[model samples]
Target: MALHVSLIDFLSVIPRLYPNDPDYFCSLCLLSTSSLCPECQHTHSTHSCPIGGLCDTHRFHIHCLFNLYVMLNMP
Candidate 1:
């Protein structure tokens, strides 16, 4: 079954990614990439998600996979 994401989660990504009106989203249709929160011990990536290292296992879309990589690498 396909997972469902809410508008609030999608809306939250715009500020982190586009920071504007998300004009880029119009072109790509789907721009953000999602990942599970690191604090969760799930074997699969989608089982837990969103930022702040939540254990809630709620999937939320962030800007892109690149953002995830960037977040992971930061000091």
Candidate 2:
């Protein structure tokens, strides 16, 4: 069985998965936050994606991942 998640839900859960890691930064935008970017200037809320396989050392903005997904899926 596979878990299916919407981008919003996936982003929402990323921060919660690493609640105590203050030094955690997004590998893409390189921003650190316990729950979303404090200085995010985008109209929509930002989320995070863990890179390097479930480790806090690497992460990327959810939007970045979404864009990458779109590009990769483009035909």
Candidate 3:
């Protein structure tokens, strides 16, 4: 049987961080080289959901998370 999931439930599977954590790397960009680079800092500071982390083994920026969510829900 096929399994169906709601957007809220699907999104809940992704991990998120609040107050900003310096140790967590971006899931989209696994490399620590740009975890908190200047660009990321600017995005985080300017964006609503500034901080985000991997749910399991994937790290990503807050914006990336939103994009992922949209992509997954796209038709």
How does each model score on lDDT? 0.36, 0.45, 0.50
For each candidate, give its TM-score against the true structure: 0.22, 0.31, 0.42
RMSD of each: 13.2, 9.0, 6.4
Q: List model 1 lDDT by residue over 8-72, tens digit each.
A: 56446644653334233322224323243222323234424424311222223333433444554
Root-mean-square deviation of Cα positions for candidate 2 versus the true structure, in angstroms: 9.0
Candidates sorted on TM-score, descending:
3, 2, 1
lDDT by residue for model 2 (41-75), tens: 33223324333222344434444556644554555
How many clashing residue pairs, candidate 1? 0
Superposed model 3: Cα runs more than 4 Å off:
1-5, 15-28, 31-49, 55-58
Candidate 2: worst-modelled 10 consecutive residues by lDDT: 45-54
Clashing pairs in 3: 26-59, 27-59, 27-60, 28-59
- For residues 6-70, write the lDDT of model 3, one tens digit per residue: 76775676544421455554445555344352224444344554655553333356666666667
**What is the overall TM-score of model 1 with all chains considered together?**
0.22
